[model samples]
Target: MAKITYIQTDGTSTIVDVKDGDSVMRGAKLNGVPGIVAECGGGASCGTCHVYVDKDNTRPLSTMHAVEDELLYCTASPRLDNSRLSCQIPVSDDVDGLVVHVPEKQI
Candidate 1:
């Protein structure tokens, strides 16, 4: 299992152990971490599961893909360079300490 942290807009943080191959969206939903609606499940079609890869800790994350990049434009929140769809990020041992920041809202 890989441990990941989800930081909310208000600065609250939730740390949970995520199973390998599970998307970050699943991790947040299963752990009851707020801000990830996952409207389309882990399909990467919904921007509702939007999150920002913590600039300080992205060693465990994969490079953004074209599909994910296209979907991010649909978010209600202001997308940043670090913005990513949680559903597009899978948990793995290498990303055990991954940290993501939740936006204030999702469209």
Candidate 2:
């Protein structure tokens, strides 16, 4: 299981254990992390499950899919090099201890 952390705009934080094959968005929403809206339910349609991955961890994740790239570019928040739509991030045993920091908002 991957250990993911979400930091809300209010400064509160939630930590969840994600099983392999589970998307980060699913893990967060299932665990009740506050800031991830996940409006499109992992379809890459809505940009609501946006998140800024911790810079250090960005290198290991798979390359961004085309749809993910577009959604990230159109998010309400400014895109960072580490920015990603959480729904597109699949958890894995390799990412077991992975940690993600949520941004201030998702709109």
Badly placed stretches (over 4 Å) of model 2 are none
lDDT tens digits by residue: candidate 2, 1-107: 78887777666778789988999999999998887899989998998899988766743676698999988888887888888898988988766666677777789
TM-score of 1: 0.95
After superposing candidate 1 on the true structure, give the runs of residues whose Cα lies further than 4 Å from its correct spot.
none
TM, every model: 0.95, 0.89
Query: Whole-model Cα lDDT per candidate?
Result: 0.90, 0.82
**Model 1 residue 60 distance off true place after TM-score fit, in angstroms:** 3.6
Candidate 1 lDDT by residue in tens digits, 1-107: 89899999889999999999998899999999999999888887878999998988747577788989998988989899899999988888999999999999997
